[model samples]
Target: MGNICPETYPDPFNFNPDRFIKDGKINPEVTNPEAVFGFGRRICPGEYIAVDTLYVLISSVLAVFDVSVPKDANGNPDIKPSFSIGLICHPDPPKCSITPRSDRHKELVQNLLNSDPTNE
Candidate 1:
Protein backbone atom coordinates (compact mmCIF):
# COMPACT_ATOMS: atom_id res chain seq x y z
CA MET A 1 0.00 0.00 0.00
CA GLY A 2 2.82 2.41 0.92
CA ASN A 3 4.57 1.64 -2.34
CA ILE A 4 1.51 2.37 -4.47
CA CYS A 5 0.49 5.37 -2.35
CA PRO A 6 3.44 7.55 -3.36
CA GLU A 7 3.19 6.46 -6.96
CA THR A 8 -0.52 7.34 -7.19
CA TYR A 9 -0.69 10.29 -4.77
CA PRO A 10 1.17 13.55 -5.31
CA ASP A 11 1.56 14.09 -1.55
CA PRO A 12 0.76 10.77 0.09
CA PHE A 13 1.21 12.21 3.57
CA ASN A 14 -1.15 15.14 3.08
CA PHE A 15 -4.95 15.08 3.34
CA ASN A 16 -5.56 15.91 -0.33
CA PRO A 17 -8.83 14.23 -1.23
CA ASP A 18 -8.90 16.25 -4.46
CA ARG A 19 -6.38 13.82 -5.91
CA PHE A 20 -9.24 11.35 -6.27
CA ILE A 21 -11.15 13.85 -8.39
CA LYS A 22 -10.97 13.73 -12.18
CA ASP A 23 -13.26 15.92 -14.27
CA GLY A 24 -15.46 16.42 -11.18
CA LYS A 25 -15.74 12.69 -10.54
CA ILE A 26 -13.79 10.05 -8.67
CA ASN A 27 -10.72 9.01 -10.63
CA PRO A 28 -10.15 5.28 -10.42
CA GLU A 29 -6.60 5.51 -11.70
CA VAL A 30 -5.26 7.40 -8.68
CA THR A 31 -7.87 6.21 -6.17
CA ASN A 32 -6.43 3.07 -4.61
CA PRO A 33 -9.45 1.58 -2.84
CA GLU A 34 -7.80 -1.83 -2.71
CA ALA A 35 -5.17 -0.54 -0.30
CA VAL A 36 -7.61 -0.28 2.62
CA PHE A 37 -9.30 -3.60 1.93
CA GLY A 38 -7.11 -6.57 1.02
CA PHE A 39 -7.29 -8.22 -2.38
CA GLY A 40 -8.58 -11.61 -3.51
CA ARG A 41 -9.11 -14.22 -0.76
CA ARG A 42 -7.66 -11.99 1.90
CA ILE A 43 -10.15 -9.19 1.16
CA CYS A 44 -12.29 -8.07 4.10
CA PRO A 45 -15.76 -9.56 3.96
CA GLY A 46 -17.35 -6.34 5.27
CA GLU A 47 -15.44 -4.01 2.92
CA TYR A 48 -18.62 -2.59 1.41
CA ILE A 49 -20.20 -1.92 4.78
CA ALA A 50 -16.94 -0.46 6.08
CA VAL A 51 -16.69 1.93 3.15
CA ASP A 52 -20.31 2.99 3.59
CA THR A 53 -19.77 3.60 7.27
CA LEU A 54 -16.71 5.74 6.61
CA TYR A 55 -18.53 7.74 3.93
CA VAL A 56 -21.43 8.47 6.28
CA LEU A 57 -19.15 9.33 9.18
CA ILE A 58 -16.94 11.66 7.14
CA SER A 59 -19.83 13.29 5.34
CA SER A 60 -21.71 13.87 8.58
CA VAL A 61 -18.68 15.40 10.23
CA LEU A 62 -18.00 17.71 7.30
CA ALA A 63 -21.65 18.75 7.26
CA VAL A 64 -21.38 20.41 10.67
CA PHE A 65 -17.75 20.74 11.74
CA ASP A 66 -15.04 23.05 10.56
CA VAL A 67 -11.90 21.02 11.18
CA SER A 68 -8.64 22.82 10.70
CA VAL A 69 -5.01 22.74 11.80
CA PRO A 70 -4.36 24.21 15.22
CA LYS A 71 -2.27 27.30 15.67
CA ASP A 72 1.03 27.17 17.52
CA ALA A 73 2.04 29.57 20.34
CA ASN A 74 2.99 32.07 17.66
CA GLY A 75 -0.52 31.80 16.11
CA ASN A 76 0.88 30.13 13.02
CA PRO A 77 -0.89 27.03 11.69
CA ASP A 78 1.17 23.91 12.45
CA ILE A 79 0.61 20.93 10.24
CA LYS A 80 2.98 17.98 10.37
CA PRO A 81 1.53 14.87 8.79
CA SER A 82 2.38 11.67 10.63
CA PHE A 83 1.07 8.11 10.23
CA SER A 84 1.35 4.67 11.80
CA ILE A 85 2.61 2.03 9.36
CA GLY A 86 1.62 -1.61 9.53
CA LEU A 87 -0.64 -4.07 7.69
CA ILE A 88 -3.05 -1.13 7.54
CA CYS A 89 -1.75 2.44 7.57
CA HIS A 90 -3.61 5.07 9.62
CA PRO A 91 -2.82 8.67 10.54
CA ASP A 92 -2.19 9.66 14.12
CA PRO A 93 -4.44 12.40 15.51
CA PRO A 94 -2.86 15.74 14.76
CA LYS A 95 -3.19 19.03 16.57
CA CYS A 96 -6.37 20.54 15.18
CA SER A 97 -9.43 22.64 15.96
CA ILE A 98 -12.80 20.95 15.51
CA THR A 99 -15.48 23.58 15.82
CA PRO A 100 -18.99 23.71 14.44
CA ARG A 101 -19.37 25.58 11.16
CA SER A 102 -22.17 27.79 12.51
CA ASP A 103 -24.42 28.40 15.50
CA ARG A 104 -27.07 26.11 13.96
CA HIS A 105 -24.51 23.35 13.52
CA LYS A 106 -23.32 23.83 17.10
CA GLU A 107 -26.87 23.61 18.41
CA LEU A 108 -27.58 20.50 16.32
CA VAL A 109 -24.47 18.70 17.55
CA GLN A 110 -25.12 19.77 21.13
CA ASN A 111 -28.71 18.57 20.93
CA LEU A 112 -27.65 15.25 19.42
CA LEU A 113 -25.10 14.72 22.15
CA ASN A 114 -27.56 15.72 24.84
CA SER A 115 -30.20 13.33 23.50
CA ASP A 116 -27.85 10.42 22.87
CA PRO A 117 -28.03 7.86 25.66
CA THR A 118 -24.60 6.49 24.77
CA ASN A 119 -23.05 9.95 25.24
CA GLU A 120 -23.55 9.51 28.99
Candidate 2:
Protein backbone atom coordinates (compact mmCIF):
# COMPACT_ATOMS: atom_id res chain seq x y z
CA MET A 1 0.00 0.00 0.00
CA GLY A 2 3.03 2.23 -0.18
CA ASN A 3 3.96 4.40 -3.16
CA ILE A 4 3.69 2.24 -6.32
CA CYS A 5 6.47 2.20 -8.87
CA PRO A 6 5.33 2.77 -12.45
CA GLU A 7 8.00 0.35 -13.71
CA THR A 8 6.45 -2.46 -11.68
CA TYR A 9 2.86 -2.03 -12.85
CA PRO A 10 2.03 -3.73 -16.11
CA ASP A 11 0.23 -2.04 -18.98
CA PRO A 12 -2.87 -3.87 -20.26
CA PHE A 13 -2.55 -6.66 -17.72
CA ASN A 14 -5.18 -9.23 -16.71
CA PHE A 15 -8.64 -8.02 -15.68
CA ASN A 16 -10.27 -9.04 -12.42
CA PRO A 17 -13.73 -7.63 -11.68
CA ASP A 18 -13.71 -9.33 -8.30
CA ARG A 19 -10.85 -7.00 -7.43
CA PHE A 20 -13.59 -4.38 -7.12
CA ILE A 21 -15.67 -6.79 -5.05
CA LYS A 22 -14.56 -8.57 -1.92
CA ASP A 23 -16.15 -10.83 0.73
CA GLY A 24 -19.06 -11.20 -1.69
CA LYS A 25 -19.88 -7.55 -1.15
CA ILE A 26 -19.18 -4.12 -2.61
CA ASN A 27 -17.92 -1.34 -0.35
CA PRO A 28 -15.00 0.98 0.24
CA GLU A 29 -13.57 -1.54 2.71
CA VAL A 30 -13.45 -3.92 -0.22
CA THR A 31 -11.36 -1.72 -2.47
CA ASN A 32 -9.86 1.75 -2.71
CA PRO A 33 -12.92 4.00 -2.77
CA GLU A 34 -10.84 7.01 -3.70
CA ALA A 35 -9.40 5.22 -6.69
CA VAL A 36 -12.89 4.09 -7.75
CA PHE A 37 -14.44 7.49 -7.27
CA GLY A 38 -11.67 10.03 -6.86
CA PHE A 39 -9.87 11.96 -4.13
CA GLY A 40 -12.02 14.39 -2.08
CA ARG A 41 -14.38 17.03 -3.59
CA ARG A 42 -12.13 17.06 -6.61
CA ILE A 43 -13.78 13.71 -7.34
CA CYS A 44 -15.83 13.38 -10.48
CA PRO A 45 -19.06 15.37 -10.27
CA GLY A 46 -20.54 12.48 -12.22
CA GLU A 47 -19.87 10.08 -9.34
CA TYR A 48 -23.56 9.40 -8.89
CA ILE A 49 -24.02 8.72 -12.58
CA ALA A 50 -20.93 6.55 -12.60
CA VAL A 51 -22.07 4.52 -9.59
CA ASP A 52 -25.54 3.99 -10.98
CA THR A 53 -24.10 3.02 -14.33
CA LEU A 54 -21.77 0.55 -12.64
CA TYR A 55 -24.61 -0.97 -10.67
CA VAL A 56 -26.65 -1.45 -13.79
CA LEU A 57 -23.67 -2.75 -15.71
CA ILE A 58 -22.73 -5.29 -13.05
CA SER A 59 -26.32 -6.31 -12.41
CA SER A 60 -26.99 -6.78 -16.09
CA VAL A 61 -23.87 -8.85 -16.52
CA LEU A 62 -24.56 -11.01 -13.46
CA ALA A 63 -28.12 -11.56 -14.57
CA VAL A 64 -26.83 -13.13 -17.73
CA PHE A 65 -23.51 -14.90 -18.24
CA ASP A 66 -20.69 -15.78 -15.89
CA VAL A 67 -17.45 -13.81 -16.25
CA SER A 68 -13.85 -14.85 -15.83
CA VAL A 69 -10.31 -13.77 -16.46
CA PRO A 70 -8.39 -14.76 -19.59
CA LYS A 71 -5.93 -17.56 -18.96
CA ASP A 72 -2.26 -17.06 -19.67
CA ALA A 73 0.03 -19.41 -21.58
CA ASN A 74 -0.03 -21.72 -18.54
CA GLY A 75 -3.87 -21.56 -18.39
CA ASN A 76 -4.02 -19.25 -15.43
CA PRO A 77 -5.42 -15.76 -14.81
CA ASP A 78 -2.89 -14.05 -12.58
CA ILE A 79 -2.29 -10.88 -14.54
CA LYS A 80 -2.33 -7.57 -12.68
CA PRO A 81 -2.77 -4.48 -14.83
CA SER A 82 -1.95 -0.79 -14.77
CA PHE A 83 -4.02 2.28 -15.65
CA SER A 84 -3.80 5.41 -17.75
CA ILE A 85 -4.16 8.92 -16.36
CA GLY A 86 -5.35 12.13 -17.99
CA LEU A 87 -8.47 14.22 -17.42
CA ILE A 88 -9.67 10.84 -16.13
CA CYS A 89 -7.96 7.55 -15.43
CA HIS A 90 -8.92 4.52 -17.47
CA PRO A 91 -8.19 0.89 -16.59
CA ASP A 92 -6.00 -1.29 -18.74
CA PRO A 93 -7.66 -4.05 -20.72
CA PRO A 94 -7.59 -7.52 -19.11
CA LYS A 95 -7.45 -10.73 -21.05
CA CYS A 96 -10.64 -12.74 -20.50
CA SER A 97 -13.18 -15.03 -22.07
CA ILE A 98 -16.92 -14.45 -22.60
CA THR A 99 -19.65 -16.85 -23.57
CA PRO A 100 -23.43 -16.91 -23.52
CA ARG A 101 -24.92 -18.83 -20.59
CA SER A 102 -27.90 -20.22 -22.38
CA ASP A 103 -29.88 -20.50 -25.59
CA ARG A 104 -32.36 -17.94 -24.28
CA HIS A 105 -29.59 -15.38 -24.26
CA LYS A 106 -28.54 -16.36 -27.74
CA GLU A 107 -32.08 -16.02 -29.00
CA LEU A 108 -32.43 -12.67 -27.30
CA VAL A 109 -29.30 -11.39 -28.96
CA GLN A 110 -30.43 -12.71 -32.32
CA ASN A 111 -33.85 -11.14 -31.93
CA LEU A 112 -32.36 -7.79 -31.08
CA LEU A 113 -30.06 -7.97 -34.02
CA ASN A 114 -32.82 -9.13 -36.37
CA SER A 115 -35.17 -6.37 -35.24
CA ASP A 116 -32.58 -3.64 -35.48
CA PRO A 117 -34.50 -0.38 -35.72
CA THR A 118 -31.34 1.28 -36.95
CA ASN A 119 -31.70 -0.60 -40.20
CA GLU A 120 -32.37 1.44 -43.35
Candidate 3:
Protein backbone atom coordinates (compact mmCIF):
# COMPACT_ATOMS: atom_id res chain seq x y z
CA MET A 1 0.00 0.00 0.00
CA GLY A 2 0.96 3.62 -0.33
CA ASN A 3 1.09 3.81 3.45
CA ILE A 4 2.61 0.73 5.05
CA CYS A 5 1.95 0.23 8.76
CA PRO A 6 5.32 -1.05 9.85
CA GLU A 7 3.89 -1.90 13.25
CA THR A 8 1.51 -4.53 11.87
CA TYR A 9 4.74 -5.84 10.38
CA PRO A 10 8.06 -4.15 10.87
CA ASP A 11 8.68 -5.14 7.28
CA PRO A 12 5.05 -5.31 6.28
CA PHE A 13 5.86 -6.42 2.75
CA ASN A 14 7.92 -9.37 3.86
CA PHE A 15 6.62 -12.92 4.04
CA ASN A 16 7.12 -13.69 7.73
CA PRO A 17 5.42 -17.06 8.15
CA ASP A 18 8.68 -18.10 9.78
CA ARG A 19 7.02 -20.09 12.53
CA PHE A 20 4.62 -21.68 10.10
CA ILE A 21 7.50 -23.03 8.02
CA LYS A 22 11.23 -22.72 8.02
CA ASP A 23 14.14 -24.84 6.81
CA GLY A 24 11.23 -26.93 5.64
CA LYS A 25 10.42 -27.44 9.32
CA ILE A 26 7.64 -26.04 11.46
CA ASN A 27 9.34 -23.33 13.49
CA PRO A 28 8.77 -23.21 17.24
CA GLU A 29 8.27 -19.46 17.48
CA VAL A 30 4.50 -19.31 17.16
CA THR A 31 3.82 -22.41 19.28
CA ASN A 32 5.23 -20.70 22.34
CA PRO A 33 3.09 -17.64 22.99
CA GLU A 34 0.42 -16.48 20.59
CA ALA A 35 -2.83 -14.57 21.05
CA VAL A 36 -4.57 -15.86 17.95
CA PHE A 37 -6.63 -18.11 20.16
CA GLY A 38 -6.93 -16.74 23.68
CA PHE A 39 -4.39 -15.06 25.97
CA GLY A 40 -1.63 -15.65 28.52
CA ARG A 41 -1.22 -18.91 30.50
CA ARG A 42 -4.97 -19.52 30.60
CA ILE A 43 -5.25 -19.33 26.83
CA CYS A 44 -7.33 -21.84 24.95
CA PRO A 45 -5.75 -25.24 25.57
CA GLY A 46 -6.71 -26.27 22.07
CA GLU A 47 -4.76 -23.52 20.35
CA TYR A 48 -2.67 -26.07 18.48
CA ILE A 49 -5.80 -27.65 17.11
CA ALA A 50 -7.08 -24.28 16.01
CA VAL A 51 -3.82 -23.58 14.23
CA ASP A 52 -3.88 -26.97 12.51
CA THR A 53 -7.50 -26.47 11.55
CA LEU A 54 -6.67 -23.14 9.98
CA TYR A 55 -3.84 -24.71 8.02
CA VAL A 56 -6.06 -27.46 6.73
CA LEU A 57 -8.93 -25.16 5.86
CA ILE A 58 -6.80 -22.67 4.02
CA SER A 59 -4.86 -25.38 2.22
CA SER A 60 -8.03 -27.12 1.14
CA VAL A 61 -9.62 -23.94 -0.14
CA LEU A 62 -6.61 -22.90 -2.17
CA ALA A 63 -6.11 -26.39 -3.50
CA VAL A 64 -9.53 -26.57 -5.10
CA PHE A 65 -10.72 -22.99 -5.64
CA ASP A 66 -9.14 -20.06 -7.35
CA VAL A 67 -8.86 -16.82 -5.38
CA SER A 68 -8.68 -13.82 -7.63
CA VAL A 69 -10.63 -10.74 -8.54
CA PRO A 70 -13.53 -9.88 -10.76
CA LYS A 71 -11.82 -8.74 -13.88
CA ASP A 72 -12.80 -5.71 -15.88
CA ALA A 73 -12.94 -5.51 -19.68
CA ASN A 74 -9.15 -5.39 -19.72
CA GLY A 75 -8.98 -8.54 -17.63
CA ASN A 76 -7.59 -6.97 -14.50
CA PRO A 77 -8.84 -6.96 -10.94
CA ASP A 78 -11.40 -4.16 -10.58
CA ILE A 79 -9.58 -3.05 -7.44
CA LYS A 80 -5.88 -3.07 -6.60
CA PRO A 81 -4.18 -5.06 -3.86
CA SER A 82 -3.26 -2.70 -1.05
CA PHE A 83 -2.46 -2.91 2.62
CA SER A 84 -5.28 -2.73 5.14
CA ILE A 85 -4.84 -1.52 8.71
CA GLY A 86 -7.22 -2.30 11.56
CA LEU A 87 -7.94 -4.87 14.25
CA ILE A 88 -7.19 -7.47 11.61
CA CYS A 89 -4.99 -6.72 8.64
CA HIS A 90 -5.02 -8.02 5.10
CA PRO A 91 -4.50 -7.01 1.56
CA ASP A 92 -7.29 -4.53 0.86
CA PRO A 93 -10.41 -6.39 -0.18
CA PRO A 94 -10.30 -6.91 -3.90
CA LYS A 95 -13.26 -6.75 -6.24
CA CYS A 96 -13.67 -10.45 -6.76
CA SER A 97 -15.84 -13.38 -7.70
CA ILE A 98 -15.71 -17.01 -6.50
CA THR A 99 -16.89 -20.06 -8.34
CA PRO A 100 -16.45 -23.76 -7.91
CA ARG A 101 -14.11 -25.44 -10.37
CA SER A 102 -16.81 -27.83 -11.49
CA ASP A 103 -20.35 -28.92 -10.91
CA ARG A 104 -19.11 -31.69 -8.62
CA HIS A 105 -17.15 -29.16 -6.63
CA LYS A 106 -20.14 -26.85 -6.48
CA GLU A 107 -22.28 -29.67 -5.18
CA LEU A 108 -19.74 -30.50 -2.53
CA VAL A 109 -19.65 -26.91 -1.31
CA GLN A 110 -23.43 -26.62 -1.36
CA ASN A 111 -23.86 -29.89 0.46
CA LEU A 112 -21.39 -28.91 3.15
CA LEU A 113 -22.99 -25.53 3.75
CA ASN A 114 -26.54 -26.82 3.56
CA SER A 115 -25.72 -29.56 6.03
CA ASP A 116 -24.50 -27.06 8.57
CA PRO A 117 -27.42 -26.43 10.95
CA THR A 118 -25.75 -23.41 12.50
CA ASN A 119 -25.80 -21.51 9.25
CA GLU A 120 -28.55 -18.96 8.80
Best-matching candidate per TM-score: 1
Candidate 1 lDDT over 8-120, as tens digits, reads 66766776668888999988777665656667878789988988999999999999999988787998777777889898677887887789999999999999999999999
Better of 1 and 3 by TM-score: 1
TM-score of 2: 0.57
Query: What lDDT does candidate 1 reach at residue 29?
Result: 78
Q: Stretches of candidate 1 above 4 Å error?
A: 1-5, 71-78, 85-89
Instruction: Give the poorly placed runs of model 3, Cα more than 4 Å off.
Output: 1-51, 72-79, 85-90
Q: List per-prediction Cα lDDT, in the order shown.
A: 0.82, 0.63, 0.67
Kindly give the number of clashing pairs for every candidate.
0, 1, 0
| Predicted candidate 3, C-alpha RMSD | 6.5
Clashing pairs in 2: 70-96
Model 3: per-residue Cα lDDT over 17-57, one tens digit each: 56356688876643433554566778799978988999999
Residue pairs clashing, model 1: none
The ten-residue window of minimal lDDT in model 1 covers 1-10
Error of 3 at 21 (Å): 13
Q: Between the candidate structures 1 and 2, which one is better when assessed by lDDT?
A: 1
